[model samples]
Target chain A: MSVPLLAPGDRVLVKDDWPEFRGPAHIRTPHYLRGKPGRVVRVLGGFANPEDLAFARPAPKRVLYHVVFERPPLWHEGEAGDDVLVEIFEHWLQPVPAERQAA
Target chain B: MSTPARPESLARLDRLVAALIAKGIVTESDLVEAQARTDRASPEVGARMVARAWLDPDWRRLLLGNGAEAAEHMGVSMAGAPPLGVLEDTATLHHLVVCTLCSCYPRAVLGYPPSWYKSFEYRSRAVRDPRGVLAEWGTTLAAGCRVRVVDSTADYRWMVLPMRPAGTEGWSEDQLAALVTRDVLVGVALPRLPVALAAE
Candidate 1:
């Protein structure tokens, strides 16, 4: 299998950017990090997305991006020790600072 | 072999036999022979392996480094099955195994997986909150042991060989194997038996 290309320090947003998928997937996203800001710290790897794999469709390659955020930044007035790091697919990410180009 | 069994029941039996054949546990040439052997064997082989590993350092290292090969030396072949990696528990690390998608097990090495190991409840909740699941299994870890939950996907399977208990200094391999249970091998149970308890 070909490795999906992704790198650390890349910024991302949810592909669907839905509130539900964000908060519920705790291993990737904590409830405090939902609707909060974060940045990619590690690029884990890539595989066929589970959604596509389940449907038996030929899924385009997707990279798994791990994001990091301070606990206080994610939660409004939350504790300091609750730092959050999450792994999400490449398609879910887009360039941060809107004007900066994603390469 | 025509009995008035219901179609569904017959289909279930066929599937069971097919699974057994695929695993090489049974063959057409010795169908009756295989059935008799399985009937005589305990359903807790996997558990026994776990317990034995916990008590033996050499065996634990062998299991963790090359599970299939080590199992083969013990007359178990983890062939035609997904690659299984056995994880050993230490003072700093603890391991838990779960099949996130489907129930894939190292049958040749550990024997049949328990019903709870393949349950939807265990599978779905394991990755989300492993400590909760471990708590249900009656295991409460000491401080500082990072719990690593391994997902057994289609490509890989995992078993946890826990650390040996403190009280058994002079025990035979057969005595050790008897303490190993299927749940312990699958990462759901811990091995805790004194020599006195083992003797009993």
Candidate 2:
């Protein structure tokens, strides 16, 4: 699948999907960050799909993104202004819906 | 240092290695060479890079702009490893690194990840309560300084270029590198002027 690359400053939302792979699927996204809103911090370029590498299959390259999230929204006790940056693959990210973005 | 592998786990690994060797998938020499390379990997490699960046502005730009290339320039072979990302800590911002899914680290530069780094407790708390985790490690940042936690969740491995400690104005690169420990590189602790020097 050809996933469009996201640029810095673009707001994106992480997908909240769970893999039902029987064995190890090598999904790198942490469960907590799933479905969270974040801003693209950097375009990290492409890397071999780890999911395919884990199963020793022919892995296609996928674009990776460095996305930054605010701490307060992630945790109740999280201090304001603190940020969390997560490296996410293009396939797992979606454009933030208009209504979902905070004004 | 990580905990020693349990005997059963070790035995299982041995069986796996034996099976691979029997299938001609891997040779004993390949395993030996890989072990040797891992043993040679150390935090000093990262410290040296930090020190050089402190002493040289151009070097710092290179390190931050392209960490893997910078490492290769410094004679650290990054063959077969994913790209390296250096997180710069500034006066108003501090950077911390963690791998939530597994123990993915900048092994080429900082050697193996510490046992605590791979613990479930750290992985959970780092994202949930980073300030609390830093406090436990005795690294208290300024009240207004934002702590940016960088999760090395995907293909990129990250290391912190900790802010240079005060009171070391005329120090050499070697001297500066000495102050940067593994904890400081990982952002669990901040580099500090030694107590004696601070008192002076």
* Candidate 2 lDDT tens digits, B1-200: 46789999999999999999999999999999999989998999999999999999999999999999999997889988889999999999999888888888899999988889999999878877888999999889987899999888988899999888878899999899989998888999998877888899
Residue-wise lDDT of candidate 1 within A1-103, one digit each (tens)? 3554445665555443554545532122223344555567655555556556655777666666656555455334422333334445655555466455343
Instruction: Give the lowest summed-lDDT range of ten residues in model 1 chain B.
Output: B37-46
User: Which TM-score value belongs to model 2?
Assistant: 0.93
Per-candidate iRMS values, in order, are: 7.4, 0.8
Which residue pairs in model 1 clash with each other?
B46-B110, B47-B180, B47-B181, B47-B182, B48-B180, B51-B180, B54-B164
| TM-score of every candidate | 0.56, 0.93
B154 Cα displacement, candidate 1 (Å): 2.6
Residue B35 lDDT in candidate 1: 61
- Model 2 sits at an interface RMSD, in angstroms, of 0.8
Candidate 2 displacement at residue B15 in angstroms: 3.1
Location of the lowest summed lDDT over 10 successive residues in candidate 2 chain B: B1-10
Best by TM-score: 2
